[model samples]
Target chain A: MSTTAVVTGLGVVSPNGLGIKDFWAATKSGKSGIGRITRFDPSPYPARLAGEIPGFVAEDHLPNRLLPQTDRMTQLALVAADWALADAGVTPAELPEFDMGVVTASHSGGFEFGQGELKKLWSLGSQHVSAYQSFAWFYAVNSGQISIRNGMKGPSGVVVSDQAGGLDAIAQARRQIRKGTALIVSGGVEAPVCPWGWVAQLAGNRLSTSDEPARAYLPFDAEACGHVPGEGGAILVLEAAEAARRRGAKVYGEIAGYGATIDPRPGSGGEPGLRRALETALADAGVRPGEVDVVFADAAAIPELDRAEADAINAVFGPGGVPVTAPKTMTGRLYSGAAPLDLASAFLAMADGLIPPTVNTEPSPEYGLDLVTAQPRPAEIRTALVLARGQGGFNSALVVRAAD
Target chain B: MATKEFTLDDLKRILREGAGADESVDLDGDILDTDFEELGYESLALLETGGRIEREFGITLDDDVLTDARTPRALIAAVNALLGAGAAA
Candidate 1:
């Protein structure tokens, strides 16, 4: 029999708010964090609004000396990891270093820092560039930084599958636990607020060019144009169920199943990758589609992507529709941070017995999906399906069950 | 050229502008002792202030400088020292 991996602790530094309490409060209230860009001038860009993390100070959470060497994304990851470690009550000094590991995803790796370094080199000279620039911008900086800071010496790794990387990171952590790793810190953090990062995102053609925050990105709605980019996200501590029980730790939820699929021909719309991922996850969880109480959708906010997700959900649940919510609409899209935040929200929803509303949603009756909107809804949710699709055609689904 | 001597008022003006504080703030007051909530200067604002100071003074502030130079007076003193050293070099 395979061992179960359960979520023991959760930490979030989202656009909604930093830490779990603030994030949950803002999310449950259906407050949108999207606003005008404050990090840089967005006057020249087509898109204006973004879900930027407000009042974040890297030095407050990290050592002042280390601030210049690390990227904003790594700093966010470190802060979230600190919260998760404290929440889990597992000090790195107490645990066997080899037993704990880190698995994180970063869609945009140290973009702000990389851009800064490039500017320094361009404007000044090569001598003015800092040496830390080489590694700070790498995709694995989050995992590396978390491991080094927390003294985690186990299998540290990173996933780069865009948005799906967040879910995949948690799923991979679950696998590590089953394979004898004692603890896994998994999730994602993205800080791509620099001018260069914004330009790179504009090339993707998925960003909403709208001026108003309310109508910026509306998934499954007729007015849906595209997604608004954002920063920060959530991180989770996943421990083996037996280990958690031994320690008398609180179990948030059980990682019942995870499924991932990739379509090489992205945007072709030939294969139903979302359906395959969802079906596989449900099958792995040993739960029928009808047993799912709620679903946290990807909510891409693109017409075709939204339709694909709606069709996938309808096909699985027999068109009767399950209560679907996309909280990402409230925080634009945090790239790699999107899925983990969804997972965190899913865990909280199951724990609180409520479904959070999808903000800024003007539901289309033709979509045939029960999109939760306006206000939070109370429900007896024991199981949830969290879904995400990456820009380059990666799809991931995770099934979480309430701890008994 | 030797380091430029700045009056308390000049230091205050620089702090207000560098820290992104409103003009109404008192320059002679205890800005550093003020809590973040009271001052309304967030982390981003501090970073921006640090960058502006570095560019304006043409000196790289060590971590110690940032930590110890909490008030406008202390920060100005530190800047003067760095400028003096630069002139000596």
Candidate 2:
């Protein structure tokens, strides 16, 4: 009797769209959310473009009590959690508060809030800083606040691994469900589109400096430059298989398997680490390479890294044997929130039987993989392989299969 | 750079911004007599409003004013004194 964990609900706060309906429409239409940075003036900055969520006034979503205390990431997380519970048809009155939990992934939490307070301290002295800065800036603050806000008091935790943290958080959610928790709120949120965030990213040397929006952030092209950093996230509800069935909930899919690996120099060392992660995920899911219907490539836009990932797919699945896509091309990369967004799209693809198009991208033939581009492709998507790689060599893969 | 000196109107505007001010109370009358709690201010609202004023005026405000001062009249006096001290300095 295997107790599988199923994705019962999803809430998304993305630059592409706010709620699941809009997100699906935008994703299906391959809408481009990238635009000039507006939160702060980017005239002095080299990296000019971003996937900003416009007109998102925080006060509209949060209570007055939670507003002053929350950072942008936590605020996004809270609203997404509310929507997820609603979509799951979960009423707190129906279940014991201690049976549920929350785990969120964020590589950098409240960078926008912390940077503002730090500026105030330096220029105006410490007295001008908000008292909320202390608890709000910590990465784990999302997990803490979401759990408290909804009374999800089961075992909870936070993942700090880079972009892969998103899938890792969901993986942890599944493990928690198997360990006797009835339900878990699992996903990632990032709001790093701030002045300080841009400045910090400039130091990474991987940012796209193209002034033209259409010409920038190409992931697998002959003229592929670096990626445009973007902000957005998705939160999903993971429920135990039996519990979800008992409630007659509409399950989106199963989080069948998750695998993560550390690669110091994947491109250099025959990149066996990424292959191992993919192989482990397939094995864990009890799936064959032929069973995977589509592949969500990391699409980092770094030439060598992208090629390494392409090569990794060729080694494992035999030269782009499966249809692959990089939907992050539309939203840039959401960092810690990136992979869960991919997972959400994967689930939607399975449910709708149509894989969303990889916007603003056309992969070159040298990649040897069948990259879906320009438009959405209708397919029998049974199993999806979503991949993510963080800045410092964190590689992860998650396999999501359609629920019966 | 010194910002423009604020007026009573500016003070009211800041207080109004801090407030939902949805209640049927007189927002134009002497706010000193009017309770901020009636205008949707919690304990942190005054401090946040005070912070905004200090930044707008490029002046240093006494931190204690956030806790000790409860009325708009008291905050206005404090702001004027800080602006005067800043100009004098």
- Name the top lDDT candidate: 1
In candidate 1, what are the lDDT values of residues A1-404, reduced to their tens digit? 99899999999999988999999999999988899999999999999899999989886777543565688889899999999888888888998999999999989899888998899889986645655676789999999989988899998899999999999998889889999998999999998988989999999999999999999999999999999999999999999999999999989989998899986575575866889999999999999988899999999999988988998899999664699999998898998999999999998898888899998889887788998998999999999999989987899999999999
CAPRI band for model 2: incorrect
Query: What tens-digit string does per-residue lDDT give for candidate 1 at B8-74?
Result: 5665454455443443455357665554334544444444455556665677877666566555557
The Cα error of candidate 2 at residue A341, in Å, is 0.9
* TM-score of model number 2: 0.84
Candidate 1 regions exceeding 4 Å error are: A264-269, B1-89
- Residue B47 C-alpha lDDT in model 1: 49
Interface RMSD (C-alpha) of each candidate? 10.2, 4.5
Give one digit per residue, the lDDT tens place, for model 2 in A1-404.
Answer: 56899999898888888888888889988997888998889999989999887767778877655776677888888988888889999986568988999988988778988998899899988767876676789999999998987888898999998798998899999989989999999999999888888878888888999977767888878778999888888999999989999999999999988889988564485453677788889899999999999999889888887888898888888986999998888888899888988988998888788989887776888888888998999999989999988888888899999987
Error of 1 at A242 (Å): 0.6
